[model samples]
Target chain A: MPEGYLRQSPLASLGLAARAATAADAAGVTMGERERVMLVNLRGDGVDRGFLDRVRQALEVDLPAEPNTAAEGTRHRVLWLGPNEWLVVAGEGEQLAAALDAALAGLHVSVTDISDARAVIALSGAQARDVLAKGCPLDLHPRSFGPMRCAQSRLAKVAVLIDQRDDAPSYDLYVLRSQARYLWRWLDDAAREYAVRIIRP
Target chain B: MLLITCPFCGPRDESEFACGGEAHIVRPADPAALTDAQWADYLFMRKNVKGVHFERWMHSHGCRRWFNAARDTVTHQFLAFYKMGEQAPDIAPVSYTARPAPRTDPALPADPALHTDREGAR
Candidate 1:
């Protein structure tokens, strides 16, 4: 197999300088981005066994069927957006899209690369939910929305897709590319109460 | 600040949902046979119920699905939120303040007594 394409991510300005810091170290919330993750929009007949099987073979992940739920595989993560639509998260977006296209050649499905369309910001720490609740209306309580759950809600004035990733009360906010800076600033202001820290991812 | 329950995404703030005016206004099957006045009625007329009403709403910020809803125009209480393909729930147009749970099946009951010409989105 050939090496993957050297596509430019929107956050390329940051240049991927590796660093790590925790909520404890930051005194409260640790805010950062997932950095260059691939986003693929997948739409198909979820009830069709053939389509589901081919999707699994292409991405090595089972398509999540439950509303606001996510399914993970070794190589990919899929979040259920609608009854028949999903957002596929991967590392190599173009390659994955091509592979899915080839694998399900005759299937009635749509696999489009939306990696450039969104920027995934990771907001984690003990008080992350509290920070999110400042403007978001979704029940971000641990008992209501916990790990493996994904929701689409508006943050500030823009629509975003958020999913609870790791259980440090960690959540990933996927906003449109144009709104990334505004949301970043919004989160910064929101997290000010908890003393949030930003680290390169 | 009404909390509308999106059938797919559970209850969400009314801010996240956009009302699509009246619902269940079926287009006449034989449009060519209707007169201009009848066509105007079909296109522009809508029942303005003060108590309970059938409407369409879109969870634009959430799952982005468009579903039907039963709401009281006067009280702004959402009585029922159902999927697009589903039938409108049965309601007796009780006072806006208090209404029992809507019953779903074939069709909702008609209540001409609830007429008032209430205005606003949905």
Candidate 2:
């Protein structure tokens, strides 16, 4: 075994180094690879009242039934992926899947704890949309795909689930763990023109 | 480049979807009762109609749900997009082609890249 070695984060080496963004341009984008986030996947019949109710009871947040919409609670963010599938995101809520699994017992459902299967990347600032538009296909306009709206698409050939967070117009992108480094590189390169500022984890 | 109006996710770029050929092909209730030719016909016979077509499309990269769309093959205009179990609209082909319905974004103004509809149609 190595005497002095430490594990590295998905984007530890590749994240744009943190620096003071100059005021020359409209607030250059700031990006950070969010760590210690919990991601849970839920698959159940959304139309079933019982299923929806139990999920709400488990997470204390209602499941978003509308397509491409996100139900953002202070503690949890529920993103609708399909008629019967959703992704629940939070900050280090390790017991969420177990809670939901216990509560949803005896039903046709699946609650998987996928926190380790993916990494979260946050892109924020005035030029955030422009940075994402370099590879993502979704129309990232404020009017059409505004805040609270979420969509799953391929960003630079890597599948990502994007949530338009705020009018800072921040975006939360969830990518597979295996592709996190590559996607980070793609985003960093895309944001170069806008003078990206990397925030510390 | 087709801007598919997913019944669940609204209109999204065609890049987010995968077109499955020929919707509404049901399996026979009793395959044992069918003749060999009938089984073959059921498996391989899909209308290669050049005009209006009914096909299945999955929002593979988005909601991951599938829906039916009735669209003109030649003009590349979408007539209707409905849920999985819903029936196709009753507009005649004459009206469907004479004045093709505009492709609504289902959310906002159109994106210019969605004009070409014939992708994955080899």
Candidate 3:
């Protein structure tokens, strides 16, 4: 209630966003026609060596070998979110989470669907970096961070993945869906200094 | 900023992960059996190797797990990342490789109740 918090029913909001974007735009946002991504949460006491290999083979993307890193191909992107967990971004209908679970079926691991647990927002256009610079600390210089580069940092108070795409000066940000309205409002306010446009996809 | 590859979370911003220390140090199994000199060695000593060396890291903000990393002490380039129990993967032969695996053993007994505290700053 502090400032920008859009409090609409989840189902209603979902319908609105879906209606605005075509299927292709939704895919770019990792949401299907339904405007949702199948998020999977994985947990284990320690690193599961065999499971990691299987994930690599299943997603066909190299697991980032460094912290605060991400890797992407034409179809999918795998983000190192924590020591015991990761976030896999795929097309809206892609069964990345299920495939990962199947790959680690017998291993000592726990996987849960978190597709709805977080809110994802894709911010493109030239001013995206300027908007993010308000809260994030990472150097956004193209030379320092380019395609396939990502970082887990805070956007105001929310934990977010700031993934830079191939498009110059555009970025995709993921956070808790519950916090979407707050983040959107914050971003909109931040973008006031520059010419900004907001679209559902 | 330093780019750290968390064994669990993949590569993330250094801000999200915490650096533990040199990865290969083992704790003394029996504190009572060792001479004071040996106990001191276990407590305060570290090679702090230059160039490519193994170190311990935790994904404190995300998955909250600890893993091993091979990083160049000089360039601060991360060479390889592996989970907690497995040995750090062999560095690519072309660039820089770690010396033969140092005698890595659990220096301390596993604490059944010990869990990583995830609230601290990375």
Off by over 4 Å in 3: A1-34, A42-49, B1-122
True contacts kept of each: 0.80, 0.96, 0.44
Instruction: Give candidate 2 misplaced runs (Cα > 4 Å).
Output: A1-8, A13-27, B94-122
lDDT of 1 at A154: 86
**What's the residue-level lDDT of A194 in candidate 1?**
91
Worst 10 residues of 3 chain A by lDDT: A25-34
B4-100: candidate 3 lDDT, tens digit per residue: 7664444557877788898877777778999999888888888766677888887765557788888888678888888877866777434445666
Task: Report the C-alpha lDDT of model 3 over A82-200, residue by residue, as the tens digit.
Answer: 54556777765676767877887878887776666666677766667767878875678786777777777778767777777666566777777677767766776677666444355
lDDT per residue (tens digit) for residues A19-40 in model 2: 5344434448887888878788
Name the better of 1 and 3 by DockQ. Answer: 1
Error of 1 at A146 (Å): 0.3
- CA lDDT, every prediction? 0.83, 0.83, 0.66
Taking the candidates in order, what DockQ does each have? 0.61, 0.63, 0.21
lDDT per residue for candidate 1 within A1-201, as digits (tens), equals 223466554555644334344333644788787776888898999899999998888888889888999998998888989888999898754477888889889988898888878899888888898888888888887787989999999888789998998789888899998888788888888898898777755
Instruction: List pairs with backbone clashes in candidate 2.
Output: none
